[model samples]
Target: MIKGLFETHINVSNYEKSSSFYEKLLNIIPLYEDRVRKSKFYWVGKPGESMLGIRENYPSPLVQRQHFAFRVDVEDIIHANDYLKALGIESTNFYGDSPEELMVFPFMPAVSIYFDDPDGHSIELIAMLNDEPRTELEIMSWKDWNQLHTK
Candidate 1:
């Protein structure tokens, strides 16, 4: 049976630029690179863990965009927003709302913020607010989430 996600591949126009972006975003250098491939590629993150592979696009043109999320500390989500802002990056809510807004799923008790990469890929930083098990999925505004938490 399959265990878990090992790695994910993202196609990019330039390996160098994409690798550099990941290096800064992940705060870690690539773990491996293969110059032998027709289209250059590099791997980031630790071995056995969920890693990311960025590959240089060949003759194929990028037709569709992609979206992915990273699980982060509850507190870090806020800090990450500020960090991205400092880097001149803007974030948005799940609904593509204000940059200052955060999205909350009441059932999951999770909060999240989203931003786009240079290639226009949607990236998200999400944090779980509670340890309770989720029985259903529910989306709500930040205001509603906060109100529920305050009760």
Candidate 2:
């Protein structure tokens, strides 16, 4: 049985840039910042809970584009979207079908919005806030971005 995910680490070329971007996106302060190896780690949740790290290490000084996602409350999804927009960051619709898009295979209890970091690594922010019992398929079903886009 899987216990839970502790944190995710992604390699990048620019440490400062990536660190700033993630800090803005996650809206959480970093737990630690190591200067010896040019690496910056941040806490995704409350202190002592869990954390994510962004290490500066590109293949050839180029941007490292990988794929990753984070889980959020369903009610907070809109706020997240707004936050991103306010920062001038644009996220691609998942699946690309109509206004609704599919980000990835059936992740349960949430929906994902596709995006990328400075290095072009694919990133996703998943929102989970449904009161009703949900199946992986149901929660992962195609979502109408148009509906969410409207006021």
Candidate 3:
């Protein structure tokens, strides 16, 4: 039977630089490293949660960037935007514009903001705004989501 996500591997040009970036971003240290394999990765969150593996990209560089997301509290979504800004990293919307415009997935009733990692990987922080069950996919603005919930 299928359980849940155990780990996800990401390719980076430099191990030290990528590791440092992830350390600050996730606020966790690598649980394991294989020096012989030239790979170092981190196990983030709590036990049985998920692992983020940062492997060195040797020989060939990434031809294109990848996008991935992390789920956080709605308030943390806002806080993360400010946090990235404080670190001089600019946050953006799905269009890669100002993050002040929060994107909403009404199907999941989630809000999200986006930014890039040191290796140019698009990272997203998403927060579910409602506990109400949804059966259909819906897309709307965060403003609409707030108003709907407040009303």
Candidate 4:
């Protein structure tokens, strides 16, 4: 069974800068980094399951509009946003229409703060609230979907 998300990877233009940015934002040392491949991989959230990977690519091409979302501790959200703002990092507000749902950027179910790494790759710092109903996530696997939908 697919237990959980193992990692999320993004191609970057400057490996060192991107690595530093994530390290600073996440407040954890990278589990592994490879200078030879111009890539850096790290683990956050979980000891073995969650990993973040970044690679170097010059003349940064605009990647397709895609984003990876992670549910984070609510307290971390405030600290992360303040840290980003202090460093002059730009982020978009997810919650707009609804005051209760408003976040740093326009999104759904959760309050998300969107920013970029040094390579201009988008990153999101999301505050996963308990109030976000389970129905908000559309499950893919029939087993998981059926289990939750039935509940």
Candidate 5:
């Protein structure tokens, strides 16, 4: 019954600020907004592929933050660091290494980078690589992953 993820929600301290940050970074236009409740929703990709909801109901410190990722094209993942840099967003490896340290996961055979939204939630842009999983490779930089495949 479940083919894929359809929707997910996260908490942000302020609706307007969080919405604006997402709008500028992701270039998303929310489909719905509740002014009184301070809630906003946006389609992460195609209208029905997935929905991302941002709620500004996090008034107390007890509210736990969240993390989410958007699947993108491999090319997009490769260039995301530069794109994020231009927007003044710092991208990093899982280890908090350099921004150029794009990541490759052998288990999932995917490439991705890590960054943060205004609310400090870990945001990732990932793309499945067109390769078989080599569990022995473990996790490493994208460049290293490619070199091994070439050899």
Candidate 6:
């Protein structure tokens, strides 16, 4: 059986631009760079825990966009939108709502923020909460989700 997600790869048009964005946004140092293949790899979450591979796209007209999320601290997820906005990146809720809004997944009772990379791929920052799942609640704004627990 599969154990866990070791690494995920995405094709970027330019290695220099994408790598620089990730470096500045995440402050992650690349672990390896394949000069011949023009691929760069970086550790995510932590070293040896997870990895992200970014490959420079070949000369092709069509592009395939993929979605992925990075597991982060609850506090980080809460402040992600603002943090991203400060970097000139825009974030949205699950419903494409306000950038200041965050999405709460009822099934997992987790919080997340959705954003796009330079290549137009959907990327997310998610944090699993310690609270029990509220499946009946479906999805809601983070504020509403918290209010339910506070009452």
- Cα-based lDDT at residue 46, candidate 3: 75
Question: How do these models rank on TM-score, best leading?
Answer: 5, 6, 3, 1, 2, 4
Q: Give a tens-digit lDDT track for model 1, residues 35-104.
A: 6542333333454566776666643657247787776778887687788887777888899988577878
Residue by residue across 1-151, what tens digits does model 5's lDDT show?
8898888888888879888878766636578999887889998877777888888865554447577888999988878899999888888987789868787989989988889988898988889999999887778988898898999
Task: For candidate 3, give the lDDT of residue 98.
Answer: 78
What TM-score against the true fold does each predicted structure earn? 0.80, 0.73, 0.85, 0.68, 0.92, 0.91
**Worst 10 contiguous positions by lDDT, candidate 3:** 131-140
Name the lDDT value of residue 105 in candidate 3.
79
Error of 1 at 31 (Å): 1.0
Higher-ranked by TM-score: 2 or 6: 6
Better of 4 and 5 by lDDT: 5
User: lDDT (CA) for every model shown?
Assistant: 0.70, 0.65, 0.75, 0.60, 0.83, 0.82
Q: Per-residue lDDT tens digits of candidate 2, residues 2-81?
A: 67777777788788988888888764667788987778887775765567787777335555567877767665555655
Model 5 stretches with alpha carbons more than 4 Å out: 58-61
Task: Name the regions of candidate 3 deviating beyond 4 angstroms.
Answer: 133-138
Tell me, by lDDT, which candidate is best.
5
For model 5 the local lDDT of residue 136 reads 76
Off by over 4 Å in 4: 58-66, 95-101, 104-108, 132-151
Count of clashing pairs, candidate 2: 6
- Which stretches of candidate 2 lie above 4 Å from their native place? 58-64, 96-109, 129-151
Best by TM-score: 5
Candidate 4: clashing pairs of residues:
92-104, 92-105, 93-104, 93-105, 93-106, 94-104, 94-105, 94-106, 95-102, 95-103
